[model samples]
Target: MLNIVLFGPPGAGKGTQSQKLIARYNLVHLSTGDLLRAQIAQGTELGLRAKKLMDEGLLVPDEVVIGMINSALNDNKQAAGFIFDGFPRTVPQAESLDALLAQHDTKVSCMVALEVAEEELVTRLLERGKTSGRPDDQNEEKIRKRVTVYNTETAQVAGYYAQQQKFHALNGIGAIDSIFAQICGIIDQHQPATSESSRQATDEVKA
Candidate 1:
């Protein structure tokens, strides 16, 4: 399995690029944020617990987040691999994720971090806020705080992957297609099965 961790700060185009990578790699889309929201909407026990912690402004414990990811993996047992987006936000989480995937006899192939400037992230989030109506994105203070938290806390996750020789920091500025091509280049280097399909997908996108 060619599992990948699509790492980046918020507003770094992870969501957008994930769609293309998924198509190119034939990977399952595992976004912990989306999974939690779905669980919360369903009012599941896990969801209630997560909601309570979220309401209290406390970070949801790693176990809860891991459980959600576990369920997702269970649900997609036959997936070629997974594009992990928005989970493993800390070193502990990264360790936990590794343990979980190890149980399945696989591991993260690479961590493609979209390295974008803080100013660019802020600008992107603020612009997205205008129409996204996401309160977190609307406020510059909140945006900056989020970025700060990511840089201080979440960014360290890269080190964990780096130690494994699976970390990459791809430039995230410039035209979306150009950046995506760079990302695809990294993925291709690591995931051999994706090479041919990736080229096909890129051609399709360009066409």
Candidate 2:
């Protein structure tokens, strides 16, 4: 399983790059934002709670998000792997995720973080806000707060993966395809021939 965590700040083009990655890697896309939105659309209790916290510029409880991830993992037993987006926003969440994956005898193959300048992100988000229709994106104050929250709180997740030597940082200030090529290069290096052959051997053994 080639599980990948696509890490980036708001408006860092994660959504854009994710499309290409999914096509190339055949990875299931597990996006917390999408999961929350579905829960909200269904008027579920969890969704209502998430909305309140989100409206207040606060994070949803870790347990809620983790449960969603757990469910997704269980449902995709035959998945080649998953591309996790907009998740594990805290060190504790990352820790919980590590434990969760371990239970399934798999682990994060790599964490690919897109490094973008704060100002560039701010500008990009504000421009996106013009048509995004999300109230939070429309407000510069909220956007800055969100960015600050990520920097102060969520940024620690990177160090967690870095310690394991699974963190890959890509410069996110270039043309879209160029940036994706860089990402592909990193993933290719991470999962070299030996890893693929090993996975094939493991599959044969399981069979």
Candidate 3:
């Protein structure tokens, strides 16, 4: 399976690219925000706990988030792969993710970092604020805080993956198609080859 981690600051088109990758590669898309919302909507115990933190405008605790991810992985194990978005925003979470995947006898195939100019991100975010009515986008102070927090917390996670030789950096400042093409290129180069012969061999063993 071609597990991929999409890493970048807010407004870097991480969600957009993840959607595209999911469609093209038949990957299970796991966005932490989506997971939390689904859990809260289902009114699960973890959901209720996370909701309290979110209601208080605090980040969800790592254990809660990682537990949610583990459940998602189990549910989606039949998928050909997974594209992770908006989780692992800290080194500890990244390390935990490594441990989780290791237990499944798989690991992250790649971590793609979206590189964009700060001014461009800020400008795009300001425009999105008016259009999307997202509170985090509406205030410059909050937007800056979000970006700063991303840098301080998540940026170092890239180094962690880099040491594992699974890091790939791509320019985020480009036409959407161009950026996507670059990402697809990386995917093509790294995905494992699982030919029909291999499939038949595995099936024979199961039989």
* lDDT score of residue 189 within candidate 1: 74
Q: State how far residue 122 of model 2 sits from its true place (Å).
A: 1.6
67-120 per-residue lDDT for model 2 (tens digits): 999999999999988899888899999999999999988999899999898899
Candidate 3 structure quality by residue, lDDT tens digits, 170-191: 9898787778777876766576
Give model 2's TM-score versus the native structure: 0.90
TM-score, each model?
0.88, 0.90, 0.84
* 60: Cα error in model 1, Å: 2.6
Residue ranges of candidate 1 with Cα displaced over 4 Å = 43-58, 193-207
After superposing candidate 2 on the true structure, give the runs of residues whose Cα lies further than 4 Å from its correct spot: 193-207
Best by TM-score: 2
lDDT (10s digit) by residue, model 1, range 1-207: 988899898899999999888877789999876787677889998888876754443467888889878988899899999999977899999999999999988888899998899999999999998997556778887788778878899999999999999999988777887777777777777876655656777666555
- Give the Å error, residue 106, model 3: 1.2
Q: In candidate 2, residue 186 scores what lDDT?
A: 70
Clashes of 1: 0
